[model samples]
Target: MFGIKKFFSKEDPQQTEIIKLLNSYRSAIFPIGVQNEWISSIEKCKSQYRILITLPFAAHSQQKQLEQYLLKNKIKEVAIAIETSIPASYKFKEIKHIVLIASGKGGVGKSTTAVNLALALEQEGAKVGLLDADIYGPSIPSLLGLVDEQPTAKDDKTLNPMQKYGLNTMSIGYLVPAENATVWRGPMASQALNQLLNETDWGELDYLIVDMPPGTGDIQLTMTQKLPASGAVIVTTPQDLALADAQKGIAMFAQVNLPIIGLIENMSYFNCQHCGEKNALFGADGGSELAARHGVPLLAEIPLDIQIREESEKGENLIAQGIKVAEHYVYCAQLLSSMLHLQSAEASSVEITFSDD
Candidate 1:
């Protein structure tokens, strides 16, 4: 039997050891981080050695640390290529990842959570797009203060998605009158949503958040089947009734084999502006218990802040506005992003592709 290095001619002893060292090392972002598994292969050229690494999330620190370690090990003049793989159920030529934001019933601030989450993901270093899938009660146009604004067509067949607050947006409200009701049955609504998703030109999006209509009904089920969703996040209030419905939302995704990223508790509590006190107006630990019951993480507990409402109504997402309320959403965004990367790492295919600059 031949040794592993027998294939490569004049393979440097230090280079082989450095490769081993990289493979054994682990970082916080990837507790089991290493080369060989993450990297495709190491190539030895006359001028420079090249190694390609694919990561579920960007790790600038890890890259720097690895470079420094290689220098210390007397291994210089190496080229490192880093690329990302966002897990998806089905492949979209343009969009890399699609996340479905859902709720069991209406009036749980599902749309608000979806809007802020999209902005937060954009802030967190991903190209994000927002799709308003709620045909009957499309609130995205109103939330973005574009209820009167109309989307133009690139041609007779394609409609240009509207943009606001640095996010590409498509909504039924943009096409039809705000006051007018959708009056769409199941199949019609599903077709309209599919048309919006397929017809709009969302260019090279990292994350396309579909603000699903509230409920575990046809629209939600249809999207799970049609869209190549990376994962889903359920939104609910910190109330028993809301938590019960949220469980159903979790179960719905589970039934369709879509991974549940986590649960977000909207209006978890209220902060008294004057006295500087906290109030669990609905109930405490409801979302937490639901997450525990379903064995999913409780991602965030957003407060019922008036400013969040005011800013949202004014077409300014709190995350974009940089208000104090933005911190919670930002935290949630970070957690969501981290969890997504972790899940993708576990679920992604082993084939690695690299981009060199």
Candidate 2:
């Protein structure tokens, strides 16, 4: 809890008004008096006030809204700090949330999206880790330019995650030769995934983004049941065939009672560099329609850009470089964090009390 008295007088009229406004704001719930840790400081100089706040989750949109509200109320300046909070987890106590990135079928650029999303979240000031859960065809190592790298053992029991671009990462690709075939049974593959997830020493992560294997199959079901995931982000192209498969993925998570964070439509369109015209190569609005029908947010409609492909092949971090398409990835990451916080808050709101007389 934060000490309000240190920053402002209890009887100050302006302070009181500001507190009321923050608590009443629906998008960014402050509850300053109770969960006062959200607020770092409040200072006043003449008629102007400067406020500093710290949020548990990334809420850039809400922060913008808050700034607008304060300015409208004649406040001179406002700053809201964002940080990652360790929400309760069913397992892996060090991790706050486990998010699986899945798709209905392959070739939709799910792995590439997962890599960029993880990097985007890190850019938003969260401690993030990436796990390549695609057993048979692990691509994270190659995607991150870590194909030759290997993870070291922290102890006899656990292995330290390989660090690249500030992300602690793990994948079977690190252990096996890329040229060799992973010929194994379903149970064997599942066991390998379990070991990779449980045995890695992911020290205190805000999010562990698992790049799940494409499709709704045995491995997918095994992970959905075994891991206490916060939710899943379904990645698909804006096409009828891809959308149909995406629906099946959604249904699988729903049947297991796992939440769907949202949907991401990759390869949504192509913007001609020469003409500056937007081309719907695959199709348009398929992702939005699917999301609307399922009551899930359409997180992003990533444009079909050649640079995105080129960079992925070279294992480069576009967000770090501040590329044009990086904005879309960052927006998706911000929304993902904000939606997770909203969902958690909504779930915690429901309480049942029992009385025995």
Candidate 3:
């Protein structure tokens, strides 16, 4: 339904005009991945045209660019709708979507990305939850300023999730002291993660963002097999070492038959506070090249801004304020939301019936 072939079937001259323009229009994420891939659809109401565009990920700048392109082509009184498609392992009753924020190795800013992304989704008008599944290094508590808060027991088997910045959250940090070491074996850690995931009252969430532990080890593998994730977002820096690890992360997900939503190139560059110059601190376009090579979207390239670091350390995510960094997160979240919607639409089209146990 999203390819150029549909437009040829229509007889209207204006339909033909739109089709010609769209043929030249390429998506930043899914460019040339599939032949005749129709990124947008149209519905006519009276004299106006309503176009609905579905993306593999979100980019606000791209949206504006497309609108401008259409306008320049003399398409007037056209309304555009943006949507996304994300793949899922399975659906959960309490949560509509489960997104894993993952990394192949440590020190890639995975936790920080997860925190900001979760808050950004909430800011973009979604009921969001953050799950600190990094058993060894649970940082959501510290990131959201919930280190002093503890969960209330809902029952013998379940605990209530803590609330902050309009997000429902659960973390291992809330259960243990900050300085206490987690001397947990693989099985013990996995069991604890399971309890935190299923034995918590998450209520009804549009998305439950899971901050996965680093590495391509037992914990990561177990979570991929166990969690009902809609998709995963890999976080990596622009350095060669980080990209190499990110490939392993992508491969691990592929091995588990998990779909990748996209890759977030965190700390891609740094902005000079005084001169307003952008310096490629790590490297240039490593993430973009990786996404291009792998046929996945490069969701966002977040700059290494001092404010982003400062606010995150203070448990005040920049996205919660009217900050510039927040805009990137908002676009990323919007793209993710569109992908999730697309995945849901595709899944629903293939209605299946399972035998009741």
Candidate 4:
């Protein structure tokens, strides 16, 4: 209100007979393209102001995604203000029995154990999905003969999972081109993993087996934090070098508070192909010794066999082929099931379905 100027400027000039026109209108409504119109009209104002609008209702997860997008773009304010809460996407719920196959050192057949254990679970009849989260060296695609395949599109923005040996499978390599290697930093690798988990349609599953890379690195940290991991299985050969790394793996998971389901001594001993007698090529009882020190179960001692490597490398489903090798995986899987309290019927459903159905 201008005080001095208004008091002095009122003069004698006056005009009579003025009419005021006013109209009352109802609440405004618009068509489908209303947002486009609003955006277009906003440019005409040029001035800036802030106001808040309320959304009628929204799913908590969807609201969070919207908030994240706004923050990502550094949006200071919007019409709608929300207390967004996004629910995390997980492969399974009440998963009670997640088995992670990991190693501290490389080239120790951790992948082999992971693949075989998943098949063993499948054979046992649990709805199982395998996640090849080994960003450094994902061998599941090659080992399972899924190297050339890709996941199918389930929806416009979602992907259907691939199946191999009766296990729902998702792998980093499956999403990328074959010739291209996913050589990315930690954040990028995490994004890839997030896509694999959130975008893929992995329906109800009994167990989700994760094949972790061999190391106590960022990837390992990300997994232990992000995944609702039930337990882990440490695989190693019987040797000081492998055992040393195996100890690191055990410790890393322990540090993250994940339970060690058991220890598997792969290539523990060599049963002479000709003599049929056990030979301690690496050392004796290294895994058992380690397990004892760590206070865990020594689940299995898989002897070093040419057949095992050959079968894995050649894309053969060795668990399906009954042998000393297959039985070792079966027994290890059973031990894990018992420790994790996995269901017997769910665990043995594969055998039942194949035989009965």
Candidate 5:
């Protein structure tokens, strides 16, 4: 069997150069903390070398760039394998990362972004889950076309997550009637969210996206402080009011010491289908400005497209339908996952201890 150690031991200059090149190559999309040990193994097969690399998150989008980079270096007959794994941490063992999708207020398409981003991550070859934490207004059931479906009990204490589009999902809407409004107080809503989160039998997942109810209120604070979330992604529009609320959301996360992964600006603009011109319906670059001000990456700027609204209304996934705008969601998922991986890497380097003085 061929291995990195043995390949280096053989003293083959060509093989050594290949390994050196791979170690030195940095993915443009990957965060700064990426290490060279990502190259898991290397083997010679039929005059071509097959290289297997492991990462903390799925990055299918960077495969082509990596291949092109290697090709440019005259490493023509090289095969690449990209695999992802959960980082070692005290965070949920079963779930690698719990990402909160939040907004300052409702109507910024937070739920839609959550659902589509979950699907996009799955599309990028990661095991993903979606948990609709919106107790007052759960839209994931409607968004995933599972409004009428209920999750089955795995045992007396746990309920199996409903599966759709290859995603493990659970929502409050699945347990309660869709039309009935949840008239519970903040603590009660927070308790229900806790129950839904703890009682669901979500199998090992690369990412579990929680579509949080709009705002930076009690429920949001409860989730941030309690859950072992890896990070958060704030969703907003280009409008001033939404941007203001987004700042509040960012501030709230900072107060709780939770990492803000990035921001997604939905309904950023509209494109005239007939004239092929772009229009800033809400406002121009508000999301970008907000992200820049907060020192967070602007993950994506989703346009105000009729197709997105219509498909979401019909409980359809744009990525499933191969819509053009689906690319934006995929890009967001890729960048978000990369950020989470980087954040985890950073966390793993730090050491914390507790002592009763």
Candidate 6:
């Protein structure tokens, strides 16, 4: 802190000269042969200290003037002479519908709903992609059985998405073994996520379901602002303990101006697989009451089915299991499709229900 406070102890005329020179060329000239190709370009002329730059139309004459001044003031090794120019594109349009599946707290089956809903949407013949934005705990690879595979990139950048269950999937888990990544700070986690969103090959998708990292913090703040999230689905259980956290999560999204597509109360009631009698394990209709109070729909109240757990654990096709759980997920997907108006005349309409399975 001391060093930072006193970094510029005093100014020397020659030192001032160097800074002035670099400052003039900082935006005007760039290192020739730089790896990043998105912005302006610079190329070092053979056998000359002077660098050539393709001037951006932003201020061609101004950039050229600055570059010339730097070359004239070149003190050899102190600063390398380079060139500059605008080459189009410093901004791009973002994806259309990014559905963020989030929870105020973990262990409420948030990721489970995200993964299955993504697949369920895909099953309805919509182009879907899944992004495991859960930097701290990425479970898509494990749940979807993509643990062994890694996402391959074209060239040194631009990753090709990994495919599973008719959905294009990419996760930090696919980049490395699950739970192997160290605790990432806010900035580091954000940087990794930026790479996933900007650099990866998401292509075109009807829905890009982002499995948000639990807790409303830096990650949530970044995604809600940076990504074009159409709406969010908050997953929660009926337990009063979890409800508090879920409310906080909903508030965070609302603060960022994202729509609440409704709430899915997972494990709302437990069904005895043997007895076939339903029991309110946590408390019935708690999520519905919460949704109504918040003015958001109680989209679905999913039962605590053993088959749901078994399928997730075994990495089996969940839809293959004929049950109300599968239908509920499919129904949620249809609701999302309707929200986004993804049902096109060109695309065949597929009826998704329990009986279809």
* Top candidate by lDDT: 5
Q: How many times do residue backbones clash in model 5? A: 0
TM-score of each: 0.76, 0.87, 0.77, 0.68, 0.90, 0.68
Number of backbone collisions per candidate: 0, 0, 10, 9, 0, 4
Q: What tens digits encode model 2's per-residue C-alpha lDDT throughout 1-357?
A: 244465676567677667656655553133222135566676776656666666666543355667777678765555654444545543466888899999999999999999999999888778899999888789999899997889999999899999999999999899887545268667777888888999999988989999998999877888778877889999999989999999999999998998899999999999999999999999889999999999998899999998899999999998898889888898899788878876776777823212110
Candidate 3: list runs displaced more than 4 Å. Answer: 1-90, 179-181, 347-357
Can you write out model 5's per-residue Cα lDDT over 199-262, one digit (the tens) per residue?
A: 9999888888999989998778887787789889999998899999999999999999899999
* 10 residues in a row with least lDDT, candidate 1: 348-357
Decreasing TM-score order of the candidates: 5, 2, 3, 1, 4, 6
lDDT for every model? Answer: 0.79, 0.82, 0.78, 0.66, 0.83, 0.67
Model 3 C-alpha lDDT per residue in residues 1-357, reported as the tens digit of each score: 344456446667675666567556655432332123334567778978777765444333355666667788998766766554333333776687899999988988999889888887877657789999999889899889877889999989889899999999999999987445278878878888898899999988878999999988877999778999888999999999999999999999999888898999999998888998999989999999999999988889988887878998899867868788778788888777666655565666833212111
Model 3 whole-model lDDT (C-alpha atoms): 0.78
CA-only RMSD, every prediction:
6.5, 4.7, 6.7, 24.9, 5.1, 23.2
* Model 4 misplaced regions, further than 4 Å: 1-96, 342-357
Which regions in candidate 2 have their CA more than 4 angstroms from the true location? 1-7, 10-37, 45-48, 60-69, 72-74, 78-80, 86-90, 179-181, 350-357
Position 116, candidate 1: lDDT: 92
lDDT of 3 at 355: 15
Q: Write the per-residue lDDT of candidate 4 for residues 250-278, one digit (tens) a residue.
A: 88988898888789999988888788898
lDDT of 6 by residue, 251-270 (tens): 89888877787788999888
lDDT of 3 at 309: 80
Clashing residue pairs found in predicted model 2: none
In TM-score terms, candidate 6 sits at 0.68
For model 6, what is the C-alpha lDDT against the true structure? 0.67
